[model samples]
Target: MIIVSASDDNFVPGLLNLLYSTLFHNKDAEFYIIDAGLSNANIDLIVNFSNRNKIQSHILLADKSQLDRLPENPYWTSAMYARLLIPQLLPQHSRAIYIDADATVVSDLSELWTMPLDGNLLAGVLDGSVHQEELDHVGMGNDEYINSGVLVFDLALWREEKTAEQVVQYLLRNRELIFPDQSAINATVKGRVKFLDRRWNFFSWKYPEIPAITPTIIHYTGDNKPWKKRRAPLAAIYEAYRKLSGSDFPRPRDLPEFTKARRTVVGLFSLRPKYWKIVYYTARCRSKFTTPHIRQVMARASQLDQAHPRKP
Candidate 1:
């Protein structure tokens, strides 16, 4: 009954809403958050927020020195890499479900916790943004390229495979790609991942066709986040749980493009310009360079396999 998620300052509010929705539906679940450089004030807010909602939560700080070796982007910080370190960090936990902060759980996770992985390293939904080309680039079948947003993992098995270390090595060799940890997971494990239902990581683009009954998990994929003013029911859903969480955190301000540009200009003085370059390089190159390193990581993976890979 363990649910895990990784977050930093940028997505702190989204993490709060996620916790609210998840704990509201599954009262008897253990929750953990990878503390990826969240402020003490924000951590205090999370503590008070969870306490007010009666949801028990554990915050695990990121080992920045370990995570710093991986590639990152402005779209995602080094905290995103923390998910890869779970098997090593939480060795005591046999299994856990990893959900993105941008996603919401509308169904009881206890049922999900009961679903067996059946000897797979992880189980996740396929990505909405993925295409045949992207799948080919990663040397995976179109259906095998999963969305890393929501995953059920067998941590002990992951540890035996040394997945976190292998992924870091793969990233070091590849150095230039988006979805760093995600791509690493796919490349290292290759075709071994089991596919979970898309409803578990339901994308907003499918909002029109979603059944009247609530989805298991609603993913706020792409740029149109629910934090600010948005037109869809997703926004309403997010707002509801946000209120349910009893969070009095300030509503973020929306800025026009001109104002955003001005703020960006001011921010540049205090920011390191190198991250923009790194993000640009990845976007421009895409996954055109993952082949060789991926092959190497695959070769390096443990050949000893587990028979009955059960979840906790």
Candidate 2:
């Protein structure tokens, strides 16, 4: 069975709505939900909406009690570890696909579900950022890294692998190396993982140089998301979810206040700064540097702009 996981707080409604649309599109899948910190009231609302829509599926509620009992890790949040519960919730199956809530399915996901584990512990696409030299520089093997945004796991192997325990131990022993649960998973399952096609977990940031995109599944990876200020060719994907859900999805629960304050500070700085242009260009340059695909797209766009300058 195919499975998708999400941990929600204030954005529970939007996530559920997106998942609901996903389910409607593919009727033969089961959804596993973890309301990491939401109240019973929110859970009820989700349940009632699913039921009303006649979306047949099981809901594995990671209640507050369960959330409170998880072992602590300096780099991992309860929400991230809550994903490990999928094996226990699966129905006599040794494999399942994990999709983040920030994602929306554009096509049927049976292909992702049928991906061969090949005795490897897990299967996922490699992050576009980490080159072979970079991996060596970081003292890691090339096979040891995979983006955690999308994962297909052998549940039985995961359980036997003691991944949870290993992650906790790594946190205790090497806290500095641990960024989050994904880091631990990549480290533990490294070299033993099967690599899936980039198309399955296609990050919008990875292929900006391409003139067109035909993605089966699109991931909103990195800090610059379609939901945020950066240019996203796949903004239509986000719009699809918004239109289906009748609400803007994946809205950051904690972003508005922080953004307002940040904007206010920036506005004040804009009035006083002799180096404001430097700051603006620096920010743009940083984005282009971090996500090279954007730079490629910008260069192409610049050429196009010069060839056909904006008509008055």
Candidate 3:
């Protein structure tokens, strides 16, 4: 499996945690880290770590001249657009798994790597946080939108179809999109995407759930990132990986008590009606009403984990 992720200096901790978690779970995988303005010291750290561990790794520097064409936001850097260049970056590989730096893998990715694409150019989970209005704006149906966080890409197909070029053109034309790259990819390859089970790319808001299947990849979506917020949902899992990664980076200071309280109040009032469904789902998951079927599913997943314990 070839795992690709992009990050700048600001996200180095998250990137290291992602690398460690993925390596801990998978035995046969290589990594390609896209350099989007990482400092020279940090780049050496990653290269030295990979060399010390005898891991196959490559650091590809992105072309700033091309990436500058994509619109940027305060919330995300232009590095987010680097995934569109995967086919062009690695011409030797026929397929690759693109995961966001903010996510951590908890299960073996071999299944995801080898899953038949069924002639689709990309495979990813449906975005749970998207609204109907956003879908309409992107000219996609309710079910057509897929999260760009965790994607299984058919690189050869992308090259043949000129998908990267088309996606870049779409994004340049639609700069006002709420989610630039995600909406562009969905719009460009509407019928050509295969939706995977949600467990493949679970969002942080859906934490502590009794889902039919356990989440293999936990995505830290939204602003309350695990590295930045001590109270962020599923943060402990991320911390475990941080320690496992053997990173000596200083931990970020938690938000001040007053600031945290203020943000909570502000967040409450900012919630729109479209978010009520997520609130209800979260409430239901935490409720003491786990069905027998859900229990069985959890048991089976637990058994599988025990059978294939994570590497120390």
The top-ranked prediction according to TM-score is 3
- After superposition, candidate 3 runs with Cα above 4 Å error: 259-312
List the RMSD of every prediction in angstroms. Answer: 15.4, 10.6, 5.9
Global lDDT for candidate 3? 0.81
Q: Which residue runs of candidate 2 sit more than 4 Å off their true CA positions?
A: 10-14, 63-77, 130-138, 141-144, 207-213, 224-233, 247-312
- Every model's TM-score: 0.77, 0.67, 0.82
For model 2, residues 1-312, the per-residue Cα lDDT tens digits are 567576656446435645754664577877767666667777776766666555555557664554455445563457766666666666477887887766656567787788678888888887756555545534676455777778887889878777656655654554444334566676666678888767777776644433234455667655545555324435444554454443424543334467756875786677846356444544553454324533443465468558755332
Clash statistics: count for each candidate? 0, 0, 0
In angstroms, the error of model 3 at 49 is 2.8
Clashing pairs in 1: none
Per-candidate local distance difference test? 0.73, 0.61, 0.81
Q: Which candidate do you rate higher for lDDT, 1 or 2? A: 1
